[model samples]
Target: MGRIIAVANQKGGVGKSTTAINLSACLAEKGKKVLAIDMDPQGNTTSGFGVDKNGIENTLYELLLGEAETKDTIVKDVVENLDLIPSNINLSGAEIELVGIDDKEFILKGITDKLRRKYDYIILDCPPSLNMLTINALTAATSVLVPIQCEYYALEGLSQLIHTIDLVKERLNKRLKMEGVVFTMYDARTNLSLQVVENVKENLNQNIYKTIIPRNVRLAEAPSYGQPINIYDPRSAGAESYRLLAEEVLNREDN
Candidate 1:
């Protein structure tokens, strides 16, 4: 079975989408069969892989509402071994539509469970908020990879996120675990970045990744070009960090 990793964070602008897009791409580059699911209604991950959201017919919206099958839903050959289950603005209304349904939280799991054998890693790019969509991702995932922005409000709501994971583990998906926390947008010149890392280490008793993604111009520009940092600018600091992160993920004995 493939490892299902939900790259999640309640706070926006924490490089959640960036991590999802690049990590999946890097893993694919390393020859792992990857399936990146765009759980966010904004569809950043969908476009980050160069898939046109407006031109696509079926998306995660159709899949979640049971309007489409997983075979018809998946966009094949997104980039080498990486496939995609794209999402668009249409997915935003899925929150209210999911109500009163039987096992709504497990709907996404039902879809992903079928595709596990075909891939090595299934990466879920969850929304910035803790909505129904995010809950669905959590229920589907084997582990959650959190991306924290190295800024002043880095620790905000972190405890709540961990608490939610615990709740889901206790009730929803007992297999769910914390993949780890990864620090993003680190600036070597700033004393604040170092402070944030040390603070999180002192407070949060979780597996933290050693590879820190620095705030690079290329990383910010790659999304606009509809490419991962590795493909967009292979020599960039952002690309190198993500590649290192992927190695750590692959080296892990748990998954």
Candidate 2:
């Protein structure tokens, strides 16, 4: 079975979606079959892959509610060797709607389990908040990839996030583990950025990726153009970093 990674962080504006979009694209570029699922209500990952929200007839919301089949929801070849199950604003209400559903947290897992053999990697872009949707993603995922912004309070709420992951692992998905933490928005020019990195390494016991994503205007502009960094500006530093991250992820898995 392929690895199912949930690119997750409860904190906002930490390059979580950017990592999800680009990592999937970069892995696809390496000739690995990848399927990215947009579980975020904001749908930035959906738009990042150039999928129009209004035009998508079948989405994660319908799939979770058992109203649509996975085959019908998947947009194949959204990027070369990459497929996407897009999400939109409507997903915002799915949490309340799922309140009474049986095994609500496992809904996503039920769907993704059937899809494992078809791809080398299945990346899930989770919501910013630790809502039912995020829980669902955690339940479905084999591992979690957190993107921490290289700024003050980089460790804030990090303990809680790890505690939650521990709870989920203990009670829900035993297969779930923290894949690693990747530093984002790193500025080699700033002492604070380097300090934050040192602090996290000292305090956190999780594995850390070597590829740190720098702050780049092109990375920020890619979503506006509806493309991943690798496709939006392949020569950009953001693209190069993500490609290196993909390589490291593959190597980590093999080891």
Predicted candidate 2 versus true structure: per-residue lDDT over 59-158, tens digit per residue:
9999999889999999999989999999999899899999999899999999889899999999999998889999999999999999999999788888
- Tell me the tens digit of each residue's lDDT in model 1 across 18-96: 9999999999999999999999989999999888998999999998998998889999988889999999999999999
lDDT agreement of model 2 with the native: 0.94
The runs of at least 3 residues in candidate 1 whose Cα sits more than 4 Å from the true structure, single-residue gaps closed, are none
C-alpha RMSD between model 1 and the true structure = 0.9
lDDT of 2 at 98: 99
> How displaced is residue 136 in candidate 1, in Å?
0.8
TM-score of 2: 0.98
182: Cα error in model 1, Å: 0.1
